[model samples]
Target: MYRLTTHSAIAEIPAEHWNRLADPDTPFLHHAFLDAMERHGCVGESLGWLPHHLALRDGDDRILAVAPAYLKFNSYGEFVFDWSWADAYRRHGRAYYPKLIVASPYTPATGPRILTGATPQRRDIARVLIQGAVQVAEKLGVSSLHWLFTADDETDWLAEQGSMRRLGCQFHWRNPGYGSFDDFLGAFTAAKRKQIKRERRRVAENGIRIRRVRGDAVTESEWAIFHRLYRDTFDKRGGLPTLTLPFFQDIGERMGRNLLLVLAYHDRNIVAAAFNLIGERSLYGRHWGCFQDFHSLHFDACYYQGLEYCIEQGLTRFEPGAQGEHKVSRGFLPTATWSAHWIANADFRQAIARFLDTETRDMQDYLAEMNTHSPYRADALPDRIQAVS
Candidate 1:
């Protein structure tokens, strides 16, 4: 037997129960991470993300699965870029707000969506959880439901269950059994390698020193400066900041080692910073900002620093946020990402299906073209890794 419940609070779910379904490899899915987002008030109805997490239980009330879900009033923080879909609904005289989104708020890192228990009923739990999402959409009268930046396994499973799968691309750097940063850089072509070296040299010539501060090492003053930079960056882009100051403080206090802040200081004064989450096997670069523009500072602080940290830490992969063709030449390979959407309205669903099919083809071609310009040597490219849409 399967039971479904809507949870307004992450604390309501037992930490051990949720952690049981989470792989130690991915820290973002750990109960601590989600709870921090909630405890800090970063996710709630007023913030445009209302927690309505779905929990599945067995006959004896044992938790089987859980999905981090939210009721989204807008698609601002989700990096998957679905504003066009919302506009399409409005153009067709339909409502698109209040859609059900299964994703991490203000995060584009792909991970498991359905957390199932270690039992024969794991698949059944996923089916039930998805059905619960559909039911919630119908009951709440929302226009649609979406699962953003999900892993390939969940995407395939959802597609098998009639959800429409959409393809996207992100540039990520993966370690190829590299023993050191220089070894990894050796794989790059001479021109690209020279370009990177020049960029690093430029940052150094400007009297800027970059340092990585782990969670515990991040002082309150540092957090304040980082938050200001984060807000200023969003403001300059003419958008509201997605994260609250308290969110940063809480993450620093609770998950400090998992938090890596790459700070660029000029004359011992901080000028730029890149906030990254350190997982067991991957480093996820989430946000970046600079107080002043310096030549190649952004690249040094965001990409190169991240790569160096990953190399030194022996991490397997580094995902430096979303959507950058320039990352290809910086040794980040084009990787395909997947999302699933469900539009309750039949007409809108068909329209989106048509649009997605064409978009997928275009994305596929774009990834292939980008791969041709990859920095890595031809033999260094892994056979398992390919650009797909």
Candidate 2:
């Protein structure tokens, strides 16, 4: 027997118990990270992120499963774009706002969505969480429910349970047991190898130096500068800067060693920065910005430096944010991303099923296309596609 409940805030749950069920390698799902958003005023009804986290409990009242969910008013921060679906609902004089999303808010990285203990009843717990979420959505009368950027294994299970599976591509770099960055580059073709080397050389020749500062070591003033750079990134592109300054400070304080800041200096002045969250087995490249434009500085601050860090730290994978095909040529291979949807309306669900079927085929063909032109040398290509979950 099981009981399911939803909370309006993550703080209602204990951090220790929640983390005990999470993969240590994915820091975005950490209680500290999600709670920071709420505490720092980044998420709330006014901000369009209303918390509605789901939890499954056992007969003894022990929490057996959990899923981080939100009642979204609009499709802003979720990188799994659903604007078209929203537009469809609007055309039919229906509502899309208040739809339920199970995800790490504002994060596009894939990790565990349905978290549970490693007990014999883990699958049963997941089912309860899923059904509980759907019941909550139906009660709220929302048009749909979505699970975004989910793990591959869970995505397969959701599809089997009648959820519509959608596919998208993101470029991610993998460490191939290389001794150093140079050794990693050796796997690339001669032309690409020289191209990357030249890009790195451009930064040094321009008298720009990069320093990788751990979060605990960062001063209060440094955190301010990093936030400014992050704001500048969205300001320049005319995008909403969803993250708050306090949020940055909070994560640094609570997530300490898990945070890494890569700052670029030219003439003793900070010109750019890239922020990463270090996990036990992976490094996640999240925020990046620059005050001044230097030649190939984005590559250095964003990609090359992170790659070098991964090699030095012996990290197995690096997920540098979302949607940049240009990263593919820079040794970041095209990887498929997953999202599962439950449409409440049967007619609309069938329509989306047809659409997703076509999208899935096209995504498969696109991945095959990217593989034919992978940056790695012919001999270095792996025998099997790396299933990034």
Candidate 3:
């Protein structure tokens, strides 16, 4: 028999046990990453993201599956926006806060929401985990449960359990065994290829030098500089900078090798940086900040540099964070991202279901239209456009 458990903090679970089930393709799912957030106060009741992680274990207390989850009081860091849903609840005189969410806070990358390792009974374990999460929602009397930025397969499982599947789009670059950056660009049309070249050259012409530094190789001073850039950017934009210097320092110490920082230097002074996490077969870009704007520096540090590193390292894909239609014109292709929701109120659930039906159709149309704007030559386009399932 299997039993479900919930912990108020990730530290309640052993890193080895949790990581054994976690996918290496998503560093954000790492126990160390979640633990650091709790340790540094990046997530808590004050930040409106309270850790309420889920774990499934056998009779002997051996963990079979795990999920990074939160009792969300407000939808702040979750990149899958649902502010309208919250407003709808308010309009109906219902509460939406204190909902349960299964996601990596502040991250929008898709991976396993339920981390079930190579167990022969993986499907059964995942089903139990999902049921357990919904049960928790019931016990807490929350409005709903959400599985955000989930893997395609997990979305199917959640939908089978009657969760409303929602489709979204993100721009990503795929590596098709390109020998070099130039080789990768060769797949693009001549005009598009030249456009990319011009952007790269503009950065160089502006005397901005970008260096890809592995996390382990980054000095303490460099981390401080990067943190300042990150925090300042958030401040300037009137957004809360929740991730702290200590949090970055902690992750750098625990999982440094998985980190990649693209630092842009102008006249020997660091001006901008892109924070990325390396995965088994992907490069996941998380954060970027700059003190001063340089010509095409964002493109170089955020997109092109990531693409080049993926090519050089033989990584298969580059997911440079979320939602940028502008990326379509610069070699990144529109790809489907999935999320699933379980609503507690029957009437609201039906309304949401109907809304999702229409939204899904609109999303399909959006993806098809976006595909028409592919930068690659007609014969060389990426063949991985996934329709909403």
Using TM-score as the measure, the top candidate is 3
Q: Rank the candidates by TM-score, best first.
A: 3, 2, 1
Model 2 bad stretches (over 4 Å)? 384-389
Model 1, span 286-312: residue lDDT tens: 999988999999998999888988888
Q: TM-score of every model?
A: 0.96, 0.97, 0.98
Model 1 weakest lDDT span, ten residues long: 380-389
| C-alpha-based local distance difference test score of model 2 | 0.88
Q: Sort every candidate by lDDT, greatest first.
A: 3, 2, 1
Candidate 3 lDDT tens digits, 1-389: 98999999999999999999988888989999999999998999899998999989999999999999899999998988889999999999999988999999999998889999877887888988998888999999999999999888789889999899999999888886889999888888999899999999999999988899999889999999999999988988999999999999999999998999999999999999999999999999999999999988998899999998998899999999899888988878888999999999999999989999999899989988998898888777656643323
Off by more than 4 A, model 1? 117-121, 386-389
> What are the RMSDs of all candidates, in order?
1.6, 1.4, 1.1
TM-score of predicted structure 3: 0.98
The models' CA-based lDDT, in order, is 0.86, 0.88, 0.91
